[model samples]
Target: MTNRAGRTGTLNEELLRKAATLQEALPYLRRFAGEVFVIKYGGHAMGDDTLAKAFAENIVLLKQVGIHPVIVHGGGPQIGRMLERLKIHSQFVDGLRVTDRETVDIVEMVLSGSINKQIVSAIQLAGGMAIGLSGKDGALIQARKLTRSKADPDSNIERILDLGFVGEPRHINPDIFNAIDLDAVIPVIAPIGVGKNGETFNINADSAAGAIASALGAAKLIMLTDVAGVLDKDGQLLPVLTPRDVLVLRGEGVITGGMIPKIETCLDAVRNGVGAATILDGRVENVILLETFTEHGVGTMIRRDDPADGEGG
Candidate 1:
């Protein structure tokens, strides 16, 4: 009986390995198959060497499969470290860096010029061709200074404080993006936008990526964060959610805190014509493939409220 059980276990292990191989190949077979995916890379995944290496490998595979993957990255941890080293006191106005002229200079150098190139180099070292870019290159993203604060919805108290040199994405030029022959080349984007004055301002990587996806008519937008996607009140992964479903959750108080804005962004992208918006945990190995290939995708997939979209599929 013991020998029989061992043989069965070996056969099961072989079958499982074959199944995983097939699952990984599905996304590759689909390839660029007329899909554009935007990925926002940040958080602890950026700090861990192993995770970063895994991220690079996954990106290379996406390119190999003919998928037009665009990368937008945040260097918050790097910026924080640099600031600390320079003894510059960091201040935030509603979660935005209060950038003065000096800070803006540092932000541009670290984000667009320095760290951007480093990421490109890493991808190349991983045998993936990559190009580093920013919003200013070829007028990719036009912007204007943002004045943000809590505003009264009742049209009573208008609180608009200058949020330094933060720029809101007014337009996205995907021409430079389309012009590239991205056979195995990836475009690493830094969240820096050009203003009417031709000045570069720090932009939020998440909002910038969402805007780019909408402009490019991307099939999907993926935001890689520390959280394990949207969870139910019981702390279980919700798996699938629609824009309306998110609204109901907000009302029922199932979603609150920092998750509110994140979910709101996901819903907005889904509503604005992107096929889907996914909030995934980058810490997972091969998460990109798991979400795109498997029947049960990883993370929370925020889809349109229109039932017709998935009922038949």
Candidate 2:
């Protein structure tokens, strides 16, 4: 009788914990209702089956809660894999893939065709309505070709190297989203833009997401990355950061390597009218829920230094 009673007690405790979690989420639900959240979903999370399903479900949950979600996805690893399979030579300068005419075609095929539809299917399977679109659709994102300059170590001479078909977002058309019923359907976007002269350009997913968030004036811009938020020198997560803090961290070399671009994206979003930007570790299950709904967030939140700008978070 005692053993049965203990088992029943444990079940009750579990139920109570779940109830408490719901209770904690109540205020956040009220606050974020009717707000748009632009999420940059990528990294190891997109590659893993279980994590992909979890991400899709979380996005659906956000929609169910009345928060509109717009997704911008990255497929770097997938693109590289495709390039290798096709026997196409690929090169990277400063982490941006040098996309000649041939490689850019392959890039668009992987990013807009396969990866975009896969995410849409995942979301649909999770009981949500999802529409997949690339930057080219509806003139969503107009882009300019990107060029890089490298300085000679000994001569200190700088020479420009054109990265064919690699581009940065020149403009984002807000009107395209104005027609969508964001309350009902989620838009999954591929970071593939078109130039003015009808040229297709491959864009960086993080930069595209930041530009979209800024153009939409989204309430939150969340980046789902491989690492645990922004870590300090000791490898501890910094829960919250301001623009000033980011500058200081960069100067200190605490924010280095690939993290630099992610942090810069977050900073750009917050600086350009997005309410708040966060970098969350996509490895964690239900990380978006933990970051948005819970009081103690699970990632690094970047907001304006002013208290008034900390509205959505």
Q: Highest lDDT: which candidate?
A: 2
lDDT of model 2 at residue 182? 89
The whole-model lDDT of each prediction reads 0.82, 0.94
Q: What is the TM-score of each candidate against the true structure?
A: 0.89, 0.97
- The residue pairs found clashing in candidate 2 are none
Worst 10 residues of 2 by lDDT: 304-313
Would you give me the overall lDDT of model 1? 0.82
Report the C-alpha lDDT of model 2 over 1-313, residue by residue, as the tens digit. Answer: 4799889999999999999999999999999999999999999999999999999999999999999999999999999999999999999899999999999999999999999999999999999999999999999999999878999899999989888999999999987898888889999999999999999999999999999999999999999999998999999999889989999998999999999988888888988999999999999999999989988888899999997786444
Give the count of colliding residue pairs in each prediction. Answer: 0, 0
Superposed by TM-score, candidate 1 places the C-alpha of residue 215 at a distance from the truth, in angstroms, of 1.0
lDDT for each residue of candidate 1 in 1-313, tens digit (9 for 90 to 100): 4699889999999999998878766754564455678898888788788888888888877777677788999988898788888888889866778888788888888888777887788788888899999889988989889877777789868788777888888899878976887555689999999998898788988888888888877778889999899898899999889877888899999889777877877777776787788889988877887787666778988888786542110
Report the lDDT of model 2 for residue 294: 89
